[model samples]
Target: MSFHEGGPRAAQQKDTRSPGTGAGTVALFTLATIMCLLALAATYYFFVRTTTGQFIDESALVRADTIRGRAGRASTEFLDWLPVTSLVIAAVVVLFVTIVRRRWTAAGIAVAACMLANLATQLLKDWLPVRPYRGVQTLELNSLPSGHTTLAASAAAAVFLMVSPRWRPLAGFLGGTFAVASGVSTLINQWHRPADVIAAFLVVAAVMLPAGWLVLRTGKDWNAWDGDGGHWASSRFWVLLPGIAVVVSAAVAAYALRELILGMEVTDSTSSYFWAGAAMIVGTGHFAMVAAVWLFSWAARRRGPARR
Candidate 1:
């Protein structure tokens, strides 16, 4: 209907995503999802399947063995509670926000995304062939995408999706941090390899990106936002902290794992370098995702002041 016949209320309900920006957003999200899936493939192939990969993968377990004591037990105990606790908290928070905002479609999209991510993890784990015994000491079963890490990351992503764009950067940072910490905790506890944690994150990204686009498309008014104001708390600090985290962690990981690249016949399982490298992967993956999603939202932002 024309604007006049459609009336004020009808016009008010118009989509916030403009046609020009909508196409771009769709393209960006599609590419991001594909890239994440590709990265996931590379991680599984290079870090989980090969003989060299198994050697590197089991290195962290060597460190975990050394640290087996009260500290290790305590860490495992905490992580045991993390998956359920984080999801419950994320669900409650997201549900409250979605209800208050009354964005029913957005809520559905977020929940569906979370469920699909977790389900995909389990399905992939069961369907993938068992890891070949490449003379590695690690378990032979397929453990690509970790169930715990998938649950944690998807929970956080759900919360990140439900928040307003103005608040999303900060929320994304916090959510991603929680997810990364959960992944690292699994490593420190010896429950999963770094590749498992990394794969879980990639799976969450693949599922959530397209779901996020749907949320934006259906709840356009709620998703729209203005450019970041001069407030440090708003956007600058959110992106800055994660940026620095990714940089520092990358440097440390590169330095710590340089021997692997040098072809030195070192297979020490008790090396702290393994844990450091795993933590670095977790940090880099989660933070980079936060920045990417935030940049997309910022690009699609409305130019004028936020709607009243």
Candidate 2:
């Protein structure tokens, strides 16, 4: 039989296509939507019924109130910087993907997806009537979606789309971590209810999955090298270097800020520090996995095989 007919290569090809199938994509999107809805419902019930707003038990309400008070002292400019940084990072990833993989369609999809996701989040926030909660001395409006969570999730999804298949799992894990962190941060700061954050996550995922699939389908395979016995430089290697630098610098800064500047105690227990560390580790793994994909693609180019 020919290579396309009942061979190992054919089987592998079928397996590869399985993930890109219409049904599979639909299933994934469905699952993401369901999870987000459930999360939103759970958070809404918790905030409305429960008397506490803190993640930790025992004086959780007190701690949440304290954090809210301290938020004023925290520079709003610095807090705004986080979303700006995320946007910059997403732009860099898109640029790298386009230049290295020559996947302009994919890059465009990433940008469009994030924009749509952000728009959806804003619309949802506007449509939902804000429920006011009266604190001991103050009152605040509770919205349906959190901007931070939305931005983080959408940006992370864009990054996940720019990398090779081998690195996608790591990219997804990192994206999920950032999404969760942003959501939790909102809760800890008492800036948003859990439902708001969950809604943001859902809106992002609903937009991202379809965008990614469309990009993959329409994008050109620019990694295909001519068989001219001349070495063609792969841009993947260079693209990975900046990602590595960003992850390392961010991790180091986070560690220092938590332990020294913030004077926070780190223990084996599940704390904010633990979650921060987890985010760093996930980010590091994503960078490393992307780097590996770059190296592997380079090697495959040299070997005259299909580049990942």
| lDDT against the true structure, each candidate | 0.74, 0.54
- After superposing candidate 1 on the true structure, give the runs of residues whose Cα lies further than 4 Å from its correct spot: 1-21, 68-71, 230-233, 267-270
lDDT of 2: 0.54
Native RMSD of candidate 2 (Å)? 9.8
For 208-285, candidate 1 gives per-residue lDDT tens digits of: 888887776676565666556633335667777777888788777666667777777665744655655466656756
Model 1 TM-score is 0.88
Residue 25 lDDT (model 2): 47
For model 2, the run of ten residues with the poorest summed lDDT: 53-62
The model with the greatest lDDT is 1
Clash count, predicted structure 2: 1
lDDT of 2 by residue, 1-308 (tens): 77668875555334423233345445654565566456556655554434332222112222344444455335343345769878887888779878977877778888888989988878876765444452322234546567887888789888877765445545555565566656656656656544466556667766775675565446324322223233222334334554664477477536633543464563323244323433433343344334333322332232222345
Indicate the residue-level lDDT of 150 in model 1. 87
User: Which model scores highest in TM-score?
Assistant: 1
